[model samples]
Each structure stands twice: as structure tokens, then as C-alpha cells.
Target: MTPRRRRMVLVALIVLGVGSAAAFALTAFQDNLLYFYSPSDVTAGKAPTDRVFRVGGMVPEGSFSRASGSLEAHFILTDYAHEVKVSYTGVLPDLFREGQGVIARGRMGADGVFVAEEVLAKHDENYMPPEVAKTLKKQHEKPTNSGPLPTT
Candidate 1:
């Protein structure tokens, strides 16, 4: 084959290889990406049920429970406006408690429960996860009283 033809073929192959690699990388990224959602989002059916994702919120007071003779725990995570039930079958963090910021990574179960593989709690007294903070803030910012305006 002529040198020019060989060079052209080589360039075409290089381009094809690069394109394939890019596509592969993108696909992997998409598959592995974990999205963060609030309890409100989950209750609204905005979270993906097929993939693992994160749900962040405050564990409401008196909503935590443990199974008898097991490490399994169940809690309700709420942004104050909505709540999602989370089940974790492991030891919880030292700082985990009711009315504190927590983030659970897992997928939604068939029974509408979030089956958490990992549960994370705020590390310090003043340090809430940014996502949890944002979610809480968003919830509080919502208008609770959407009433008709009064006129003079």
C-alpha cells in the first residue's frame, strides 16, 4: 500500500479508537454516578429506583428503631416537609441520632423503603453535610402559608 494510504488508515483507526474509549468512559461514568436527593424528592418519585443514590435529611425525633437481636435499624429521614423510611443492617455511626443530619446511600426497595448499604451522619456538632443542609434549607424556604393576600 502507498505510504499516504497507510497514514490515512492509521489516522482513521486512531480516531475510531479514541471515540470508542470516550464512549466507554462516558458509559461507566453514567452508571457509577450517585445522585443526591432529599426525602421530599424521594417521596415525589424523583429518585431512581434502579440505581444506588443518596438521600439526605434529619432523622426526626422518635423515628429510630432497631430490630430485636439484630443490627438492623429503621428510621424516618425527613426534610420537615416530607419523609423517607430508611433501613440499615449494620452498626450506625457514633454521631447518628434523631433530629440530626444524615445521609444514606442505597436503592429504593420494592416496598418503598430505602435499603441503605451505608449510612453517614454528621461528624461534628456544627458540621452538617452540604447536601443535607441544602435540602433542609430548601424545605424551610418553601411557603407554608399560601393564602390569598389581604387588601386594605
Candidate 2:
């Protein structure tokens, strides 16, 4: 009922409103965030199973395949130490090819295949995605070789 009490109440309400708005914005941003992972990470079971994420690697030689009369395609992505199978039912980018870097956004299926929603290919031979480069560097830096990478 007092003027001072009314101002205090108004300030409290404003603070509460701002806090709620900030919380909402952060939540939305987190939901849209796509994390990049390497084939090694995926093989180690570190990739998210219920949400979309990104996998970056090279399209190994002879790993890319397409069905006749269909847009469906399959490819094996490799980081040299590990590999992942990816399936995409869409037109690939012009830069897409074997032995090239690529980043695929998708979720892993129960059958251990990556169901890609979108595929991004490297622009040039010298260019590689930062995440992919980092992953490859780490793989090479390891002192011991885990196993031979799968052949296409």
C-alpha cells in the first residue's frame, strides 16, 4: 500500500521477468547446438543416440556407393583409425568425392548406421573442417595404433 513497497514489488517483478527470458533463450540455444564428433568417438559410443549431431571424416577410397535410379547413397567415413557407415537419401554437394573431407549431420540408428539428414563436403583438398582436423591430429598423435583401418 505504501509507495516504497509498490516500487520494490515492481523491481522484483522486472527481475523475475528478465530471468525467465534469459533461461528460455539459453534452453533454445542448447537444443539447436550440434556437436561435432569423429568416427573414433562414434565407435567409442560417445555420440548422442537421441539427438542430432555431426560426424566429420574423409570419404575413404571406394567407399561411396549409389543405387541406380535413386537418390539414396551410402558411404564409409574414416578418420584412419576408425570408420562409420553413413546413409543419405539426397543430392550430394559438388565437392563430395572419395578421399575428401566431409561433415555429416545426423543421428545414429540402432543398427549402427549414421542416418544423415545433411551432408557437407570440403571446399578444397587443402581445406578441412577444424573439428575433423583436430580429430585426425589426435588420432595420429597416439603412440600406439589400435588396429588397421577398414578398407573400402
Candidate 3:
């Protein structure tokens, strides 16, 4: 083949290789991609139990239970109307607290508890995790807490 033809073929091969790599990467990531779902969604059966995913909600008051070790913790995620128990064996975020927002990644157990592989809290701004935002948005319409306390 001529030099020009050879160079054209080489360029076509490089492009095809790059595209194939990108496609493979995207497919692999899809399986690994974790999506955020609210407690309400989980209860509604919208969350996939088999796939690794994230659930975000407010820690229900009176639901946090400390285990013997600093590694294990049990808590509940609530969207006002629904709740799911969560168990995690790892260091929790500093800002993680009851009534605050949290995002836990893991799978649901047959016993109905969420087995969290990791837990994350909001880092900056007024942004809560997407799942928490969804829950709070739903709860906003229902009859709930009146408002913040009236400071003297």
C-alpha cells in the first residue's frame, strides 16, 4: 500500500481503538454506578436490591444506636412517612448526626436492614444529598413540625 494509504489506515485503527476503550469503560462503570434513593423510594420498591446503590435521608430521631466498637453503628433513615434501619461498619462522617442528612451506600438485607459499605455527609453549601433532598421535598407538603423554635 502507498504511504498515504498506510497513514490513513493507522489513523482509522487508532480511532476505533479509542472508541472501543471508551465504550468498555462506560459499560463497566454502569455496573458500578451507585444511585441515590430516598427512604420513601426504598419502601415504595423503587430501589434495586441487587445493585450497589446509595440511600440518603435524615437520621430519624431516637434511632441512632451505638455499637461496642467505633466501627459499627446502627441508625434509621426517614422520609417522614417511611423509615429504614441502616447498619454501617466504618468511620462515620464528623457531621453525621441524628436529624441531619446522610448518604449510605450498600445493599438491603433479607432481614430488612440496610448494610452500608460507606456513609457520606454533606461537605459544603446548603446541599444535602440528592436522596435526602427528595425525601425532604416530599415531607415539606405533609403536616409536620410547625417551624423553628421562637427565640426569646
Ranking of candidates on lDDT, top first:
2, 1, 3
Which ten-residue region of model 2 has the weakest summed lDDT?
Answer: 141-150
The top-ranked prediction according to TM-score is 1
Best candidate per lDDT, number?
2
By TM-score, is 2 or 3 better?
2
Worst 10 residues of 1 by lDDT: 137-146
What lDDT score goes with residue 19 in model 2? 100
> What TM-score would you give candidate 2 relative to the actual structure?
0.92
Tens-digit lDDT string for candidate 2 (83-126): 99999999999999998899999999999999999999988768
lDDT for 29 in candidate 1 is: 90
lDDT of 3 by residue, 16-93 (tens): 999999999999989878788888889889988787788888887788998675788999988777888999988888
Q: What TM value does model 1 have? A: 0.93
Clashing residue pair totals per candidate (backbone < 3 A):
0, 0, 0
lDDT of each: 0.94, 0.95, 0.86
Worst 10 residues of 3 by lDDT: 123-132
Q: List the RMSD of every prediction in angstroms.
A: 2.3, 4.9, 6.1
Q: Candidate 1: give the clashing pairs.
A: none
